[model samples]
Target: MKKLRYVKDEGMNKKRWLRGGVAICLSAAVLSGCATGQDKQGSQKDLANSLKVMYSGSEDYFYQEFGMLFSAVYPNIELEVVNTLSLENTLLDQYNQDMNKALDAFIEQEQPDVVLLDPTTITSLIENGKLYNLDTYVAEESYNVGGFNPGLHDYMKDIGGGQVYAIPSTFRSQALFYNKDLFDQYGVPYPTDQMTWDEIVALANHFPTDGAPSDRIYGLEMAWSKELTEVVNVLATAEGLNYFNSDTMQMSIDTPAWESIVEQSNQVLTSDAIFYYDYIYSGDYEASSESSLGDPFLEGRLAMKLESNYYIDTIEIAQNNAQDPEDIVQQWDMVTAPVGLQNPDSTGYSMFYNLFAINAASTNKEAAWTFISYITGDEFARVQSKQSYGNIPLRAQYFDKGDGRNYAAFYKLKPINNVPAYHQVPQRFVYEFPSMLQQEFASISDGQLTIEHALSELQIKGNELLATEIMSQEELKLYLQEQQDVLGPGVITR
Candidate 1:
């Protein structure tokens, strides 16, 4: 196994403050209820029991509301919900050191019962044995493990194994976010669930570019970096070209699937339908950008942008720039990514979200599990679906809400009916693989290098990184075996 590294410069100050906030919120809620100690005995027991959890937070209103609601239910639990400013800051401590000392120190000192870990952080924590194996917990409780999206569950289980280390809290998938006003102005058909990439291109080409500011409106835009590269990878995978071959332990960007990806990107870049000039590159997807594709889409300068459900919040925020923000977003809608001929079933997408896990060393294991169960349970899933404007539910029933009321819009936009099978196995190569491929692909997109050369070099450089910087094949096998021991034998396969 690879050596565990520590994050640096972590402080418990924010955590302390958040704990205080929860206490204050719960106290207010309890006092406002006017129910005495005897009347609220059961409630008090549920609330007063202390439990600590770590999460990522932003100005997103839903997160705050969820935290407050969680506190209200378990008044005694002393919910310590810490929101690290960003995934990178919390996980790598600004990349200051080879290790994550700061995060490690906090985990060691506070010993939070439950943690909301992102995929990147989950990878590190699982490797270090800092998280509990949740497989037994799920099986013993009959926790409806099969209720979530099979693809997403497989992705998590592959990473943390059958141990069920984490439960997905939310999901964000890439989709075509279009400006309704712009589509109407150009007399373009409103985006539908059945639209193909070629059809999207054709729609984009209908816009008149008559050398006027208004004529400059284009078809689509995407944030071109490691973050957005997942879209391309998803599309390629859907086309039947796996990025990594676990059996051969090799990267396969040299295949025709990869060629299809390059061709698709190139077509978009060089297309007359869109404005590919002044490409804005940001390492982080959620960063604030005045000229971001989202901004332009809101401004009516761009017709469509490829983004995730998380962008729905940003889109609402961006509407402040609009003369009529409400009407714009109300009319605005999203659709699944364009389909390909080879993988007619391919979704051309990927899902990103935060996962909730129990700490291996948590003092309050039962409390932690209770909290995890409560938040990720079917009840919470329904609440979350309503509160989080565009978040896709991981639970199957939530998606299957037959009336087409809750989260119906999101499920409608899903690219494929069947979940991709690749997510079922943890790809040891994911640690640094996506970012590496992103860099190479970006160069090719920018015309700095040919796709052929880039893929050839990527294969060689990727192999070197795997051999030297990543876990050896033997070590990976051992780790997989350990994961299976905790999760169960069927959690992973060779």
Candidate 2:
């Protein structure tokens, strides 16, 4: 067995953080040429090991999806899963309903061998030295890390302070899905990869916008949401704009760049070239069903749509179940998601939901590594590649959908930095800011306020919200006084 070193907690899993950083030592194991059950159980072939894993869903579901398959390969290992649903509920109650606090405590208490975490949670654990550095394990087992997406590996290394602490099972990315038949019919050229927002909007304007709501053929459709705010937010994020700066406790929404984006978004949203579903009329189920079951793109009424890889399955299902030849789309392909003008070569739409990590203090480290290695190995990718989970498998080679579509579009663009802006501020601000943005945009659309004025108001109100939520009375006074001295009086309302 290989011995590894980890941080020692002084109290009951309660320490500020490791000041000196984590300690890791190097070691190597003989390489396994094949990812077979016989090759993987080299050192532990004779011993029976029982392993516990922490999962988001129920144990039965995990077994049905993953555990069952894993057990079939390595029957010597017995698997048990601890569901996090009840754990989160109990922790939430104990920690005054503060989810971050609850999650911190949850990690300290639930010391399972293997656990699933989000990127932010993984970062927190890495900082606290609660996660084992997988560098040694990968080296000791001679695991091939090259098969996974290069971007996800880079992201993990960055967050883990140049040492790998976790590996993502799958990644979610957006792509530009266009109807080939619609483009040909409209005499418009097809959309291409790395096209900027301005270019996409220009392309969308080519189709004629002269017909009834149901009968109209829109040039562009955003399948995620029909709300204008969602569109603006997606566009702004692609441009690498951060709404709020947590360090300076400042808002960046009221800039000239933001005003320009608002204007462009308003023009595109109000134009007849785009399909903005009216939720008021959505009460009519029959009317909605006629419109590709709420997806205009599937009905061939849309020229292009921006959606995740999962939408492929939806389109495939629609095509198979079409009552008539025209009821569902027959021909469609995808390109990369729209790029930002600032960083045209990269995108921010790529993300991973399930990041697997091992506890630093687990007693069964060998068994845990075996499971992690098995799940992220070649055989696992080969098996999962056959199914459509609406996500890209880590090992891109095995990703075969049987059709030669542009599946590479999902991962063609290098990912822009994965630093989440929401993690910097209070969760309340993250939840509230979008609605606040929408309300101000509504005023602009109603002609009650200009774009510049709306953004200015948004900035001031956002500052006030942050002040009340993040600072004490005395601190707020000092902050406001400093702000007034820099700018002018009446900039920040009391």
Candidate 3:
């Protein structure tokens, strides 16, 4: 019997080692050679074969369990896994390489049969034509591609204008995870899936009270790190908002929609309904009040938190490692993140999703297809439902039977109708602008800037930066291709 391990942050892992699925107890070994398939009857004499897999910047448990599971099915194939710069977002960031000489390295180094890629990495590979189109293989196998959310398939094709380059195995989405005990203690019902942003904020209001001690529980706790941007990005995206207009290359932040997001967040922050760790721990939120703060949520000082699938393992690890069995943190579960007012039906956004793709350049396409097919299939879904890694499976069936983790709530509501393109722009100009927005949020917390002035200043400053950040199509294309290396002949330009 295998137990759960703490997962790293969600951005790096769509494979968010769930609490269920194949356990990683199998020596943490990877595929580097060939073997035979495992048989229920216990004979592998005829199933002898080989398959090589390459995955980078991921937990050893994923490969350990995956190797164990895949080997069991086709024990005859030697499952070799190459682990390298597997850092979640490092693939495209590997800009140090010229013309994607990285592909040159693959030819000289170990040529992997299958490459486990995140959306960004997969897109890069697709542009370089390093990936083989799985359409024919998918069709030949008549794979039940319908088990996943239709949007996933649509988004993958949309990226390449109808070519299936990568298969999505796991994804991360935001959810409202509440401390059930707190809700119960106050006789407040747990948050529902249909709750709107204001409704959830209203729910948060139920927690903090004047009579409570200085250690009075906070209403809601957001990770406070980068989530500020993520929350706003989700809202803005759902409303069809973008910081930079790709076509015009202009910045447009002075709008009512963006203002609503800032205002609502301001309301939540001021009302003490939301606790940002930095706003508190930085001695800022306490600049006015004698509020108690720390890793309040981890220390059991918070009643609720906004998180994505990535947070599951961290919380699980905390629960498992607590000094005393039941020191505090009552029962907790997640629900779909609240929807926006204007786009009340919008599903929130995730920074990235883990995608699995076959190496079109692999010599063993047949065996590679077998591996990719099985792992993304219902059979793997059945296997995944058995564990509680932080990552959520794309299949609905797994959610129906998953363990005690409340995995279903993560997907209880649909996500944004589409996956937004990975933003790769001038970090100094386009990206840093959001940080200014956060600063305004912080300023609002400090009473240093009025909300109106903050928005006005944000717009003015943003547009100034946009002038330098805008690029022509040729410039944008070059920017996208920077640091990219071709692993083989397969590449495409969007």
Candidate 4:
């Protein structure tokens, strides 16, 4: 029985790993190989008669449901989808061991026509030449690109090198979730879309300590994970510091922006307004004054938490599980992150989303492209919006069309305001910048390193990584030239 359990767990793990890996690998292999059925003498219809689509298991339902709609529009095509749902632990282990092999093997075997992938994963895969170029298809087809925010479209190009490699299906931005019940208890105004960081701090400071010194409420709870590093980047950029210059491939850390972040963090830490997790070693929040964001916020302990729009589903789940569901509903609400000086009244941030791309080497390129179009286009967006997919629709028109309950709730949630300057950085930079900033910033916040020491060390370590892991200037120039050749001239503007 023990052996049986181990075998079952192992099998489940393998299934999960294969789901993400196989889809990725198949998509990569298609970029390298010739289109399916091209060598066999046949008409366009014959070439597209049957095709296989490899997609992540998480996306299986979307493919099946929306896929039927696509077929209804064009019956000549047949899509056979393969689902792989690999365990997270297995993928992490593989990632540590170079991260490309399992995916490569899957691509070499299944040869799927279309694939959906996380944007960061796609960026790394693209760097290794594992995907197709979609320039020709995008140019020829009259896609409703106009509906997308121009900044987002431009950011996609910077990552895809003007090839339109993938279609942005959904997007997420970070926001501040506050407990309305706590505000009422403290007689504080609810945070607004236009609140500034200073204002947030002031609001946090107003919580009455009362006669008992130990009974103080914490103003904020921070997650401090690598994911929140984007918050740091946005804040830095808003303070007028450029962390990365994609044009010159230089990293600058010794700026006013960095200084501002360190100072602000210190203020938040030292202030009576907030109590961080590290402040209390006692894990029991009920026995202590401090709490982590998730626990405290859900239990009505903390006043505010910085979270992504994706947290809405989790919030809803927690609310459902509450002893009094009505109490949960009355307690929580989300607002955009505090505005910075540069973007005063606006949220300074960046976003990434899951996207669908066609296999460049598929024997059925046209059919695959058609399927991709249908999946990412208006019809699929509407259906996806209705399903509570923790995502906002990419198409502007679909925002108002879905069911009043789900879609309307999402619409009431504000769209994050972002600047063109914030969106211009390459996708690779966006992924790496956050973690690097977090590591260095955490050291400073923990008092393990001083501000100057942190900045200097960050520069040294960052340069070393850039020199070793990232392509050099000469290599990038050559790559850009090659991409221009495949995509035709003027696709990438300097």
Top candidate, metric TM-score: 2
Q: Tell me, by lDDT, which candidate is best.
A: 2
TM-score of each: 0.59, 0.79, 0.67, 0.59
Over the stretch 1-494, how does candidate 2's per-residue lDDT look in tens digits?
A: 11122121223111221111111100001011124556546667654488888899878657644676577667688998977875555776565544556666776786788878777566667777778999887665457777676566677787677988987776778889999998999889999999987788789899988876656778987523455576778788677777777557688888987877777777667656876545214442123243245566776778988877777766765566666746788888999899888788778877766778888888887788878887787777776555433446777777656587788888777666555534346444654566678888888878899988988988998887766444333544576678688757865442
Error of 2 at 200 (Å): 1.0
Clashes (backbone N, CA, C under 3 Å), per candidate, total 21, 0, 47, 14
Give lDDT tens digits, candidate 3, residues 1-494. 11122222454443434333334422222121222232232533443377777765444555554656676666667876676553222433453322234443553366777776655445556767778898776665457767774356666675545888777667667777788778888877788875676787788888865533225677776545434454565446535566655435455666777778766655554565666555443443322111111345555656777777666656655566566536535577777677665655446544235566676677787778777777777766656655555556667666653456566666555455333232433433543565677777677667798767877887777667756544444564565465244322233222
lDDT of 4 at 40: 21
For model 4, the superposed segments whose C-alpha errors exceed 4 Å read 1-47, 52-76, 80-112, 115-151, 157-165, 184-187, 209-216, 225-251, 275-281, 287-294, 326-331, 343-350, 359-363, 396-450, 461-494
Locate the minimum summed-lDDT window of 10 residues in model 4: 1-10
Candidate 2 has an lDDT of 0.69
TM-score of candidate 3 against the unseen true structure = 0.67
lDDT of 2 at 22: 12
Q: Per-residue alpha-carbon lDDT of model 1 for 1-494, expressed as tens digits?
A: 11211111113322433444455544554443333323534645544277667765552333354555555555565666655544333434333322344456657756667776655456567778888888777775456766665455556666665446887676656667787788887788877664666677778877765554322566766533223264465445345466556445556667766876777766655565564323332221121234233344655567876666566655554565545555344456677665566654445465545678888887788878877776676655654554433556667566443533223334433333223233222344444455567788788767788878888888887666545433334565687788778868775543
Give candidate 2's total backbone clashes.
Answer: 0
What are the root-mean-square deviations of the candidates from the true structure over C-alphas?
12.2, 12.9, 9.2, 12.9
By summed lDDT, the worst window of 10 consecutive residues in model 3 runs over 284-293
